[model samples]
Target: MGRGYLTKEMKILVTGGAGFIGSSFVRCFMEKRQNPVVTLDSLTYAGNMANLEAVLGLPRHTFVKGDICDPSAVDFAMKGVGAVVHFAAETHVDRSIDDSGIFLRTNVVGTGVLLDAARRHNVKKFVHVSTDEVYGAVLEGYSTEGGHLHPNSPYSASKAASDLLALSYHATYGLPVVVTRCSNNFGPYQFPEKLIPLFISNALEDKPLPVYGDGLYVRDWIYVDDHSRAVDRVLWDGRAGEVYNIGGTKDKANLEITDFILNKLGKPASLKKHVQDRPGHDRRYAMDSSKIEKELGWRAECNFEEALAQTIEWYRSNQGWWRTIKSGEYRNYYEKFFAGRLAGSSAGSVN
Candidate 1:
């Protein structure tokens, strides 16, 4: 790991820090380094403040309610911030399919806003947190840092645009920008809309667990803690104008994941329902993370099975947390995305 130059103030601005992965990174930053942390979040439907409750009210942590695409908001959040770790964006693919405009505005334009602010502020380091989906579906092996991006959906294409934009800042204006793309991240505090949490939550309630298409869609899984740690390492030690892949190398099919969750919950496998696949659903995704492992010495310390059980336990114990989320706009999402798809299915109507 590169020994980063110590700045006078260890303040880092984290965009989208109230979201799932963002919140996890914030927690890791606080507990690991105890540095002054400023989080900028739009508090969108998926952005819940309770995710950061553990770190709330601490002097080292401050939350700025704002949008990343708003120049004034970003400029205000970047004040006195030595570094910017960007995580703000619309991530849900189904939502992106329904509306690509938001993805473009938030992921690409918002990234440009952060880059311009970081450059104007002369921030020491800028790490852009991205996803492996930007690589699209990889049939076999893995996608390295140099792999060509072939994003298939609005969600991934927008993220790819942001990744390129962040790097361009390094090339054109000499911003010390580093990009880290990781595989699917799962752990506590993840919004229930995602795969693991959604399945776990639905299985708990006897709701139909909708598996898209054949349910064989493959995705590489990484525990959220390892991703957060790797992002920290990248922000501090990674070279400018470089991209790193952070992956746990744990790949599983959608059907396999659903079965694992249902079995773990002692639920019937009959709960699994095959729904119409979304448009442009990638066939498979895998990631190669040798760069971060070799350079930053980061690896997954959490066992997949153990961590998954812990995740299920989290949703079980925190019923109120997910229940509240599901009771509101999330229900509308289910109706909008899955309700119509499951119209003729044998499984009864879903919430």
Candidate 2:
């Protein structure tokens, strides 16, 4: 609720700012506030410039094409930044299953690189954006911020390590670190590999919606914009060396989400395919978000159904955006069109 820490001229360094949630935060921040932003992203398969088209050519937004694992890129992006919102990481469970090494490198070691840069640069605030999977499966009650971390998959284990490392920076060196663990995020521009987007796009194409196992694995879902707002709150007012849980207050099983998407798209149940569940799939994820609500006065503001409908409409409207990624054409398009021009340009050229 307080804006004491951020000034009008302060520039925020948002890592992974070209990705889904990061782009949402950038758009939200630009609309509500006047702070300049420097976005550092490697432009990976999931990170797309099309996702950030809204703010790409704006005067206040700067996009840097670079990886978090690169110290030079991190340092270049950290310059003159008042706050650091760390969102750069490899965040796919299936991909991690295929190759866990990249997850460890990008999530753990890359976080260390950013934290050290924040420390050396003396940034005003360092917010480490993390996930609820760090608590593994919350079978019964909610997992609080202080709950034990039981990361089952390699991706979550890497995130858990990054969370601890980010907090350790505050504990050991007083670097002003705040960590936020959020539930499943769904909204526009999400890479189709994620469950909600994947199902939506698949149903749209009249393809099979692969429902894992019995299709009953539950997760707490939050709209991406609400999660962005919560992160903005933490970036400005959160207590250092502390963790906050952010949730949507909507817990639905996998089947519920799948059925909703199929029905919403006017598709039939026969399109549902029962696939073997991935290894170590967490049964359910629930979080207690009371800390952020009570202290920061932030709560999830959007209804799940309404937000989900809006997201479906977004996909419908932006077929070219998701279709290119689905067909593997976006990579070539990106390389030929955007990547060559923006790579290491540093002027934030939108052309």
Candidate 3:
């Protein structure tokens, strides 16, 4: 219900635009251009309305609460949209480990529905959001765009399936599809269940900071805004039927990051609690993002230290936003995942 600067050819349909990275992209895309955006989300537990409060009532931005697997719902949102940016998926590794049915249904079947709708509706572009974890653990070198997909967890496997499904459309049916695989994203508005935000929320309340196994698991971290910009670049500049990798260029161990957070918050290192590692937890993930960097001139511009500090500050100021979520099923899940895992360990576990 708002005026927009985009023409008839620029209207975009963004699925899962209410989640962390999706919301960031929606805001960035709107701010960068006057494109009219129609966001379709299922309003799941992790999809919070507060994330889009900034642009909820803005001109040319609309929100539709619906599932991506619903063909009628997808067709409704795709009416005037020229492009589709897919961000909807069951993304949590732990949750997928617990129950993978929803992940496969949402990530695979939902993507199928979206691809069909885009093909039928003559959408100009389809940017499918994916993760670098689909490449599994990179012990030595970085994962290139064409790296073998050895997804170690249900969550990543579902995404990999979706990735292949999207590319198939481009190859078999000539759908203009582009896939983007991004590394770990940490920034403001992330759910309290993610590693960075979870540790921060627990630390604020003087709770134990759970560290998985030896805590040497390494991951490349990218700021959510930087990721959003990268996605936008792919949407506008990437070639059809190609894949791009987006990386933060900064790799840090889990233990190092948790300690840094505690130190930054003026908390003690004594809060470190080592728990049993989840099954099939990938030890490391690296990305060779040169494709996106060289092709679209999109590089992650946020420094890790600066962005981490900024994220911590945002959590400090936005207690009301996270306090509500942390007080819900997340608390129970945290207890089950961490406390339960460590309950039988000796005192050495708290080191």
Candidate 4:
């Protein structure tokens, strides 16, 4: 929470700064670090300006509407920026299965464009926000930063491709690039389509809780704020051209998570409904974050249970915010974005 490491004059450009995790980073940088931040977001379905309302009038903050794949826009944003935090991507797994073209275009091609701009401008650092999904499913042990990438879905594959592209620039052009792959993050302002938020929203409305398959798949849950803090650490002291794994060290099965949500919402257990599991669903995922902890002295400080409760409370208090997002018009947006796509037909499959 201390601002000992960041300088007040540091200027940073954050792509995808209006989305869930990106928005959290923007808020943290503006309020906690007191650094000058310029945010670029394409205003996709998931990106909302309402998330940044708190810092809208701050002099040190600026927001631009642009695409990361456009060299001109990337170049314009990179000028005089000390660092680049790349978070722009097509991130939904189900949507990736439906249509991978956008995923490839934005996640892969967009990263290349940003890297080129950063290299040309000689930015001090380029931090790429990634996901543990790049490592695919973990049958047994946890995956470390050195683990081989075996991305299973179009979304993960796109991210893996971007990670490689960023590192390639670092290796070939000596660009200061660093990558951080984090576990599942849940917190306030998350879009309702994601698992945690979707379930929370439905449960609050007394709707059926959709459980894919038997709901045995497992994943590590990290509070969004804690993940944001880890990002700050990597930006400050993390080694260049290195990959760091950030995890909460808390693993929960999908069924357990569903039960927790039901209990938190005071919903009946009978609301749980079994549905057909998506094809090639990864069985489990875990992360070994010792590298970051030992090297950068970073660890997740938020308690998962408490954070989950707080998130539920946030949704309860902010019903109007999500109600507008769940209207019939939003359903039309979903259909247009993912029309004529099968659940399991994609170029990438989990290993």
Q: List the residue pairs that clash in candidate 3.
A: none
TM per prediction: 0.92, 0.96, 0.91, 0.91
Q: Considering lDDT, where higher is better, how would the candidates rank from best to worst?
A: 2, 3, 1, 4
Give a tens-digit lDDT track for model 3, residues 114-227: 999998888888999999999999999999998899999999999999999999999999888999999999998898889999999899999999999999999999999999
Candidate No. with top TM-score? 2
User: What lDDT score goes with residue 274 in model 3?
Assistant: 98
* Model 2, residue 14: C-alpha shift (Å): 0.3
Better of 1 and 3 by lDDT: 3
Write out the backbone clash pairs for model 4.
152-349, 152-350
Deviation of model 4 at 36, angstroms: 0.7
| lDDT over C-alpha atoms for residue 123 of model 1 | 88
Quality of model 2 by C-alpha lDDT: 0.90
lDDT by residue (tens digit), candidate 4, 196-230: 98989999999998899999999999999899999
Provide the clash count, candidate 1: 0
Superposition error at 74 for model 1 (Å): 1.0
Worst 10 residues of 3 by lDDT: 342-351
